[model samples]
Target: MSLQTDDLLSVQDVHVGFGEFTALDGAHLHIARGGITGMVGPNGAGKSTLFNVLGGQQAHQGGRVLFDGQDITHWSVHRRAQAGLTRTFQISREMGALTVLENLLLAAPQQPGEKLWHALLNTAAARQHEAQAMAQAQALLERVGLWRLAHERADSLSGGQKKLLELCRALMLKPRLVLLDEPAAGVNPVLVSEIADFIRSLQAEGMSFAIVEHNMDMIAALCDPVYVLAQGKVLTQGSFAQVSAHAQVVEAYLGGVA
Candidate 1:
């Protein structure tokens, strides 16, 4: 299917494999800018694999990935990130030894003036940039509701808090597009709602997101034009209500809902 003008990310006939196992078979999807899109399926349905490919974490065997109209099929993960793409893993990837503020600082893209030679020769400039980065980090921490715990070690936070920190770090990069593996997994109910609200707030701010989540309720709440994957490919896509009522989706979920 062709993507509309509002689409920010597109995947066409993409295929991914691991040794003898093929995880994605001609999978296709589209995510509009400034909105949320959910990918839902049963276990081992290639949801995570597709996320990796789109994020440039894994190479695809065929097809292409386009972001903001540029082909990024061959881009490395860091390169893609530099080009305004970012993602969070299903399991939080926060460094245990780093404080929350430190994590945010690390996520900030390094400035050319932060190099050793520039720091030694242009001390004033380096310090000025450092101050700016620090201010930005503080604001992000507050935005994600983690300012009070900014100095705490990342490992000390609860699962829900870690997820929040991850979100903060992703935003610290000022990403235009974010692929979230599972923002609500392992999070408490209160925190899940907070995360959902944060997502909506970001969407309001013009960020685009592609989320892989199993929580149907969360999908119904956050996603529009949801895509359902089965056997490594898109089985169907439509509004949440439409996909929920699809006979094929119902059969895919439970032999038969009847």
Candidate 2:
């Protein structure tokens, strides 16, 4: 599909391979600005590989990635983050030793204290910026219902809590778009609801997201324009009801009869 003027992220005819194995074959999708997009496919369908490609973790053999009208096919992971693209993994990336509040602080972009000279020579300005980051982090933690445990180490969080923390950290970056991998994978029903609610809140405030998930409930609840991938290529794209009723989509999940 061609990229539209309002698309926040787009992948055009992307390809990836490893020796005899081809993980992705000319896959393409567009994430509209300020909207949530869902990606669902079976295991080994190249979903994860596609996420890596967009997040700058894996290099595509061909095609290009455009974010906000800028070509970022060769951008590095941190560069992508700096340019308003950030992601959360299937596995949490929290710093176990750090307190929950500290983790959010670290994720905030461009802390002045990151430079040695600023830490020593510009203590006043560095503290001002840090105080602002701390305020923002606390606000996010409170919104996610984690301010109660702000002083606790990240490892102390349960699987669901860690997922929430990951979401909170991504917000600290003020990302224009976030690639979420299974936000409700192993989370309990209560926390799953919380995650979904949190996402809806963010979406209303103009945060765009592209999520990879297996939970149909979450997908149906949150996604508008969903992309269904089978055998590494998009099988169909539409609303949840439309794509779920597609013949190929059903056959992809439930093997077709001979």
Candidate 3:
């Protein structure tokens, strides 16, 4: 694909390794602004490893990651998150002790209002900011259809609800690019549709996504340009139909299904 210079996320010649084991070998990918892209491959194809690198959990041995035209290759995970690049994990991280709303509120950016001095002397401003954060959190929860369970402890939510809650937390960051790692995993078929709808809704609102999923159906339904990785390198990337029909992609990643 001919990527535009306005792409929101770009990875060029990215190589990541864990000592002797190499995860990504000169991997290159990009996501356009407001686009939903899918990354698919078999287990051990380095999809999750790439996610860790991009999300700042893992370090890359070579190349760079550019976000919103800035080189953020060396930024820490929290710094990248603060800069509008957020990701959801394959395993959910809902705090059992915290309520759903509390989890969302924690995801909100901390400001000067959170300082002890500001809280004691600038009560009015702090209250105003807290109220705004609450309103934003509630709106995000409602958007993800979790408002009804806002008061419930996050641990009490079902698998699908927890997945939805994760999405809500990521949205609270008001991210420019979201890297979703199997958002539908552990979700029921019914709720999977809901998650898909929620992702579409977010895409419509000017957010971009690069999703890693094993479900071809979900990729087909949600992703535009799909990238197939094999042995830690991109095998092919195109529309669902185009990539699925590629002979090598089918043989290497799709198990002969084309």
The segments of candidate 3 whose C-alpha lies over 4 angstroms from its true place after superposition are: 1-3, 112-114, 120-122, 254-258
User: Cα deviation of 22 in candidate 3 (Å)?
Assistant: 0.8
Which whole-number lDDT from 0 to 100 does residue 128 have in model 1?
A: 83
Predicted structure with the largest TM-score when compared to the true one: 2
Q: What's the residue-level lDDT of 133 in candidate 2? A: 92
TM-score, per-candidate, Cα-based? 0.94, 0.95, 0.93
Backbone clashes in model 3: 0
Q: What would the per-residue lDDT of candidate 2 be over residues 120-201, giving only the tens digit for each residue?
A: 7778877787888999999999999999999999999999999999988988989989999988989999999989999998
Across 1-258, the per-residue lDDT of candidate 3 in tens digits comes to 333586888888899887888889989998888999999998888998999999999988898898888889999998999999999999998897899999999888777435666667877877887798899998888777788988999999999999888888888888989999999888888999989998998898888999999888899999989999987899999999999999988788556243
Q: Residue 189 of model 3: what lDDT?
A: 89
Model-by-model lDDT, in order?
A: 0.88, 0.91, 0.88
Question: lDDT of candidate 2?
Answer: 0.91
- Rank by TM-score, highest first: 2, 1, 3
lDDT of 2 at 163: 97
1 versus 3: better TM-score goes to: 1
Between candidates 2 and 3, which one is better according to TM-score?
Answer: 2
